[model samples]
Target: MTAYEAPALVISECQQGLLDPPPGAFSGLAAQAAGRGLIERTAELARAFRSRSLPVVHCTIVHRADQKGMLPNSYLGKMAIEERMMVEGTRDVQIPAELGPEPTDLVSSRATGLTAFYGTDLDAMLRLQRVRTLVVAGISTNVALPGLALEAVNRGYDVVLAEDCTAGTTAEDHRYMVDNLLAMLTRITPAADVIGRLPG
Candidate 1:
């Protein structure tokens, strides 16, 4: 895919809680991310964006300590509240050190909802920066990244999914979403190609 002007790289839900979960907590996803080298690839993309003076936004999922405003309507939502997963200020919610905000990058954290744009200032930040395209990479291709892509599209931003830099609960699940679902919403791309196409 050709590089689009004013593109921002949005890395969603790449927090420790999701990608490097505790024992017995989302082990499948953790394994998948590690096996696919998701962190390394995402880091590469982040660096590429930074080098080009492009925006790098980290979309993190986090909840308050009291769980206020965090709905328990869905199973995952309920689990997050009950298990205290992704609590703000906790290590679980922090992005991995391998990939960072780096003092220059922006971070948009959401207390509720699945997609980044829903409850955060992500769109406003993008608009302020005049970002026209969004390059997404991160965990759970089964859910969050796909949701982010759809939302970005609806918001009139072009989207490109860095397939190699994302991971789902399993390889099969990841492939299915990328092939059947995500492909319909955005251009599916590899990290290397995206990096190469970026302005130096």
Candidate 2:
């Protein structure tokens, strides 16, 4: 089999609230994403994957209006609840306009948790598509992307992280996580490299 056999693009937390947060709400993360051109790179990757008919899974985090089933166990969680971010029907939970889900793409949304797989059918959706390798991208390499890489691996999927298509709270934080944590869990590659390797 080829290196990227049955590969799928799994974009995590590319939502407006997370990647393009309002003023005073994760502004640092928004700045980092903009500085690195994270959305544009991920959009390029998404286009390439779509061209190959590969599954493009958007793993989003959203909570209900009442915040039921959502736990404030961590600082981010508590902040999300307190800030009223990522509520289901809000624009904050929606993916940015740059990257389209298109007609064929899959969106797997979860009400709680950091990783996409914890309370969602992301794995099942991928499995249904016969996906073997996961090309991951999106926000905050410090948390979501790394968590996604680990969860994808534990669930028996090979992971390839598009380094340029993701960011963190800060440039230094992003670099450190990619070098120390994510590097240990996934094959860290640039978006162009991933696109070039896509099977026609």
Candidate 3:
């Protein structure tokens, strides 16, 4: 595929939830992505994109805007009183060291929605690179995954969620989001399929 045709991979936040925290298929918020297996899965995807010289983007949520701007009018909004939970310069919100590509492998967010582009420069960055397709894999599908899928669809991009490369806060939310996207926004491809496409 040409650079224009090369698919880009995006890994959204697999960080610890403010309340639930990351769990190990194992336990704990310390390794949200690591615990769910996405950490390793995404590493492989990242390696492939890197080897192929494809554009790879990382997104994290750290509500820099007001609650109304970030969340709906509900308890969840009230709960997330602080902004910048995963801001660029925060000690509590660093990407796992196990994941690679160096410090250069991060894109900071100033809002708290699924689509990192909601209030950030994500779309601009991807647009600048002429990326029209996206492969998203991460934790919290119900939140980030859906948000990304919706946003990508609205922006006219082909979005694929790498199943198994991501997991949600709950089985129902995960299933629902995937099903919802499949019905309307995007497609869900298994991680194995994505891995097989790597330039091995």
Candidate 4:
């Protein structure tokens, strides 16, 4: 399949809580991404992809009040408990306003764990849409992005990392994850490159 055939723009954990964290709760990488305008750039890419009739999937994290689906004894669970993040019906878990996932956008919200693919229908939904290539964007490249990319590659889907559209806990960490790890698994390009390649 061609690079652009049935591509899905998969955004991971671009949630309000993480992107715009409460005072003193923000991570350096997230701040860096915001400072570098990753969120705005990603929003533009999402809109461009949507305008081209491409699939736009937003993978978010939202836990129940009881946190039944949340994995315990883990960093994610610890953070959830400490920060009180991603509670069901809470505004913290909502997608950022700028990205603005429309009614037509596919949303995959999971409370289980970090990876968007695990215990989620994201893979199946992409297949249903006949997606051969995935233009991946969003936050925490150190965790979710790599997990998603690995799973996508294992599932035989071509993966492309939207470099300017994602971030980690630190700029160096993000760069290392993307350049040293994810880059080997998937083609890493700027959001503009990915957007420009879309079929008109």
Candidate 5:
């Protein structure tokens, strides 16, 4: 079988809040990385995946204003209280404009912490679609990308980390995670390679 036949792309936390950080938000090295055009690269990959009729799954973080779905005292709650981000029904929680999801795309959202599979049914959804390979990308490579990669492996899915499509708080942080921890679990490849392998 072709490498991409049973593949599904999972984009985690590529929301407006991260792509376009609000004033005084966590716009550190990660923001600088995104500013360097990671978002555009990711969007292009998403478009390519859709063109091949592959499943494009967007995993986001959405929480209520009253913290109804939040894990109390968790990092998510602290970020929500501090950065004031990802509140449900707000622009912060929406995926950015660049990688706009089509009506046929699958959107998985959680109200709590990192790892899209935790409070979401992303694994089951992908399995239901007969997806055995996962192409993962998105914000904070130090956080969500690695977390989701491990989870996908535990659930018996082969994962490919989109090296160019992910960003972290710093260049070192991004490189270290992919080269160290994540590299041990999945193949760290450029998005271009993955896209090129898809059938026309």
Candidate 6:
């Protein structure tokens, strides 16, 4: 068997929102990350992680054919009717090229709207490769990253979110969520520190 790899990243759809405006689809803080180089930076980080021969996993949200409303447990379930729910195998659910994912990297979940790990067999993949710690990056730091961190920690994995690699709908929203929500669950370390801790 292969050795355990370093922590991996998971990104949410900043280009395609759960719901989007007609002009750009996703126009919130996640959209802002694109304008300010979030995608590029994420890809750059992916490359660095890859160079070390560490495992790099990608996560995206998609829905089943039923395409129904939330199941009452999801944080997203309480949202309004205009929100865009994941419909499996749609264009909005595709992984961005910057954080390229092959057929194996995509994980699916009918219950959890947060990650590709839960409901999917990603935990098995991580365990098989012996990965016990995670370095997470993505859009909507408030929602996606923190939610994912909760899931990972619950499953006995050490998680550190790359603070600079994530963004929210607003600068303050991002800051507040990280300070209040994520801080409660995990450490909010900078991307540079994450790299420093990795193999050189």
Q: State which candidate, 2 or 3, has the greater TM-score.
A: 2
Q: Which stretches of candidate 1 lie over 4 Å from their true place?
A: none
Model 3: per-residue lDDT, tens digit, 1-200?
Answer: 22224477888765544323433321322234445577877887787777777777777666553344655454444445543234435443455655544544547465555456777888888888788778887755656677777888889888877887887656666677677764477667777677565443
Q: For residues 21-101, could you state the per-residue lDDT of candidate 6 as single tens digits? A: 345344576465865477777777777777776677766555555646446565465431235545566555656655676
lDDT of 1 by residue, 27-127 (tens): 99999999999999899899989988999999998898988888888888888988999998999998899998799999999999877888799999999
TM-score of each: 0.97, 0.97, 0.76, 0.94, 0.92, 0.78
Across residues 1-200, which tens digit of lDDT does each residue of candidate 2 receive? 24588899999889888776788898999999888898888999999999888999899988989999877899989998898899989999988888877889999999888888988889889999999999999887888888889988998998999999998999899999999999999998899889878888
- lDDT scores for all predictions? 0.89, 0.89, 0.64, 0.85, 0.82, 0.64
* Candidate 5 root-mean-square deviation in Å: 1.9
Q: What is the C-alpha RMSD, rounded to one decimal, of candidate 1?
A: 1.1
Instruction: After the best TM-score superposition of candidate 1, give how far the Cα of residue 34 lies from its true spot, in angstroms.
Output: 0.3
Each model's RMSD to truth, in Å?
1.1, 1.3, 4.4, 1.8, 1.9, 4.3
Where model 6 places Cα greater than 4 Å from the true spot, the runs are 1-5, 12-26, 68-75, 78-85, 102-112, 115-117
Give the clashing pairs for model 1.
none
Q: Residue by residue across 50-97, what tens digits does model 5's lDDT show? A: 988889999998886777755546765676866657888888888777
Worst 10-residue lDDT window, candidate 5: 68-77
Candidate 4 has a TM-score of 0.94
* Model 3, residue 80: C-alpha shift (Å): 1.7
Task: Assess the local accuracy of residue 22 in candidate 3 as a C-alpha lDDT between 0 and 100.
Answer: 35
